[model samples]
Target: MSVTFNDFNLQTDLLEGIKSMGYKQATPIQAQAIPHILESKDLIACAQTGTGKTAAFLVPTLSRIAEGRFDFTSTLILVPTRELAKQIDDQVEGLSYFTGATSIAIYGGNNAQNWDQQKHALTSGADIIVATPGRLIAHMQMGYVKLDQLKYLILDEADKMLDMGFMDDLMKIINQLPKERQTLLFSATMPPKIREFARKILQQPEEISLSISKPAANIDQQIYLVYDQQKLKLLQHILKDVEVQTMILFTSRKSAVNEIVRALQKMGFEADGISSDRTQDERESILQRFRNKQLQVLVATDVMSRGIDVDNISHVLNFDVPQDAEDYVHRIGRTARAGTKGMAITFVNERDQERLVKIEKLIERELPKITLPEAIGESPVYDPAGNRAKFSRDKGGSGGGRGGNRSGGPRREGGSGSGDRNRSSKSRGERPAHVTAGAPATEQAPRVAGAPSTATGEAQKKKKRRKKPFKPKNAEGAGNSTPPAPAPAAE
Candidate 1:
């Protein structure tokens, strides 16, 4: 027997709100969580981002508030990022429209007037307050914000908050709230740390876990193994050929984000960069432009990995492999949302091969390898175990073998015929005529049958030059450093 919102025994006004939002059947998380929450039971739910957990908790809480129960700020929801706080707050408004319950989103992106508005809402309570722990702690320190009448405390994306280093802030916020309140904890995954935190916060709570953590089935994942120097050129080649209506490119460093954005712009693509160094207002503006289609590509760091919820992201490109496997899931999760199919492309360099293997293990499948365009030259082979033998490049392709030709081709500008004869002898595994055991270090040696050549040997002189690392113009724009520690703002 399938259950609907009506089976949950929600208030008529709340049911009407649900209908207005076009939700007829409850998702598994909603059906299981709503009832337990309405019965005033604390819950610890393990569900992924798109599993409808937000409505599962919000609908029941709003219904309880509509019953005219004792209320000042009836519910408090703590989230990890400012963007998530606003997202949940927007959902709260939509669901509570028919019930006349008011709510506010508290985060750090605004000026004095915004602070005053939040102060007013806190003083004269709203039915629900959705906030980021760091921002809320800033307000609470002023001693004017009130949560004494709080009845429900919800921690949405609890694991994400911990990942963002909000444990101290979360504990401070919890201590300020009344102990008798109902506590609902929702996380996408159940790591050991999350379990320990839940044990401390939730008391005899009902636990419900949905499908395990994995990228949605609709995402089309692709992997490319290319040398670091070839990455930018390959990206440009792909961008020229692929359908990139609106996409996000994730890099491991903020400096890379800036560099990619600049390079993309030079290639005549509309793109912008976002990092922690940007003030809250600047970040919001960049996001707004992205949402409005004013920006075609957004290059960002892991800071935007979790909270961003743009629905039309046609693709996600990982310019550098993330160090953690779980972060790979979150980065690609930004796309292929709401059951829409999307593409995720990852660039793996020789140094990052091990990280790629970890991602493959986590996702439980080897991603399909993509062949680089011919213009990009030879690429590294995928070696998950770090033991795969390197292949010899075909001489017909571009680039020289050794000193005979600088460009790796048959012809050299000023080389004598001896260089050409030496090349042939080297290929044949016979020592060059002028070479001897005690020859100068620069003297060339021939490859013996299947033995490694100078190019592959320790005596190899010419190596692929690595590009200079990108540096931010100023101290504030350093490589993905967390925004300065949170502090109270002046009203």
Candidate 2:
């Protein structure tokens, strides 16, 4: 049986705040975690996305703080991303409206006025602090934000922070926290790494594990076996076929974000994109628009997968398959939130068939694959095990469209932008694109002191070559000598 906020016997004013948010019933995670946190016991919680885990920790912690607390920053909520920090801070403000639990979100990315605000929040103190690990560490290094009197320490999205390699920062922050404080650890997936890490910081914590590796049942998942070039065309056809109020299109490559947004916009949809490359302020503005239903579609990379907290998302379209099977869950979890049904569609190309197979195995069921539209051309065969050479790399389409130029390599927009580089190489769990084929191991020179770097030497040779463009080697009446050839990257 599900419980309501009234059953928690929370403070009257605190219960008023919870009721004001229209949260009548407690989610399973909330039911399981709230009581333990109220009892001041260390807890480790595992729940899927969109399951009210944030409220699970926040409500009980706030109730405790409201039971009679001074102004010493009683609660510390540590998250992995600045967006999530801001999200929790917003929720804290809402849930603590009647109880008067003040909060400030501290994150990095600006140096001037932003720093001053963070410094003020740190020095003046608030009832709660929500911060990203790195930014909190930066403030902590300045020796102003103290937590000796903190009553509760919460690690939200603990797994993501660990995956982001914040173990050292987490430990450093934990070391400074009061040894007698209540600690709560919550994560979407309860991987073994999380349990191991929990053992280090949590003291005999009560364990609450819900469905961890699977997406919510409210999501109607579907798959499409598509050739790479057919993705945009099929996307356009589907949008024209259905009435999509709002959709989030996820791509593995940040470089593809802008192109997908551009293509969709050209098709007469109000579209925009957000990636790690965008400034935090820009991303916040775009997300605010998206949440307000001003944009019909939002193109993004995995950076927004777990960070986004918007609800009523009509659909989630995967422009490209995610490399991580777990990421597939979070990407699709953006929709079908809070018991509302939503659709999730994925595009699987020849190169990502192996990843698709792994996703099915992780989810413990094969997704229903839809046939490709005939007008878009034939899709590659979906034979992950026996079809290594079944599909040709160059068989998607004419590689020409307003969507993007697919005939050549990634559209070299000309500059040092990250979009111009091979993003697939830098994504987690994938090997760099510069394999032995791209760089011959036999040609690697030994590293010695004063050795000229490739880019620097290339720059010097380019200057020498440009000094006399009209001259050739030993040419008469042009120049005394010829310049060396340009390097490959310089070209």
Candidate 3:
């Protein structure tokens, strides 16, 4: 089943670059799509992340362009995210290094002056232009980019572009390209909308579908049902285990990414966050550090899940559950790359129950749940207004009051102290106790005027302790033991 690049009749220069990278045989997607693309036929490829999709298209497209048969903006590759655009640009550049084919990547968040210089370079015209749909449209409208000579079009992460509300922009860019050009649409998941979009754009395209429902067979999926408060503790425990080396932690929101990064750092993990808020340069630096193995963990939103092709990621952690099922696939897909085995762990809270069910349906298999630490209780409920009444229901008509009487006549302080023990105990753990019908009593400290609550304070302290460098017991014992006598030298 092994097929070499030479077997595909690729240009000598491109093959040289491929060999220089120490790759010989084509991956499944590369094996299937390269031949079709080499034939100058339109294609719709359904390949998941980490399946060598980049090479599948880049190799064939570069070979076609190097034939010197096309003119005008000969090839255009559009991606949903700026990160992905940069990734595609890098891949094409690397593969075309030996060839004289020129390529440029333009995306949002860059200064117009820089783009102006790049656009001028493209005036003689680029062999290929990898871009984000928004930036590409802007360039096309401003007359900086020309597609009349465009012979090939690529839409990568088509589902993601649609999710980001880029259907209009993608359609606009496609409309501007030549009608006689070849089109390739690659997506991890194909929804009805993506199929409809493909129907409108592609003309009799050949189809290549890989595993679209399940995670890579090489990846081990596990879920941990933990209370929201203890999730961070569990993450710290898992990170401390020797098996985990490098990881990409996915959060649902930009804000959550920031918080997770800070919390993880406080716990002594070399972690960082990347989101739309970061500057392009900063984002690139983070990715570079991650690739160099200088960073142990990268906390990111779903934006970094796709198009990031780091090879040594040992694990993927879902700190915040993904809202979209497709994103769940992509998040875990960061690991188990290139036929390597990896692990993905998700923290499922009570609030995430419904979404987790939906994700299971999408992937068409139930994710096995991991046994959580006994300290971690049932998943904590999330309330925007800090009101527990919506989640709590009383069994008896005690009518103590809806939402539990907050005015339970000021709780008595345990310690024997004068001068208003209520105020003094308030400094201690004197928060309102959550009393359910027959459940064991648990006391939680009330919110202080200016200090963090007792629970938050305890969690923070534990996090700090976890981050400290761990010294092995053997090493400690050896240091305390007496030195042995030297042995006689051998003859």
For 324-392, candidate 2 gives per-residue lDDT tens digits of 677788788778777888889999876567778889888898899898788888877778754433323
Regions more than 4 Å wrong, model 1: 69-71, 213-218, 227-229, 333-341, 377-491
Model 2, total clashes: 0
User: What number of backbone clashes does candidate 3 have, counting pairs of residues 3 or more apart or in separate chains?
Assistant: 3
User: Which residue pairs clash in candidate 3?
Assistant: 267-467, 431-445, 431-446
By TM-score, the best candidate is 2
> Clashes in model 1: which pairs?
399-408, 400-407, 400-408
lDDT of 3: 0.69
- Looking at candidate 3, what is the lDDT of residue 483? 44
Cα RMSD for candidates in order: 19.7, 9.3, 21.1
Once fitted onto the true fold, the runs of candidate 2 whose alpha carbons sit more than 4 angstroms away are 213-220, 336-341, 386-491
Give the per-residue lDDT digits (tens) of candidate 3, residues 214-249: 788888898887655576678877776647688998
| Each model's lDDT | 0.72, 0.74, 0.69
lDDT (tens digit, per residue) of candidate 1 on 309-360? 6767889999867646777887788787778899999998665677778788
Which window of 10 residues has the lowest lDDT sum in candidate 3? 423-432
Could you tell which candidate, 1 or 3, scores higher by lDDT? 1
Candidate 2 lowest-lDDT run of ten: 425-434
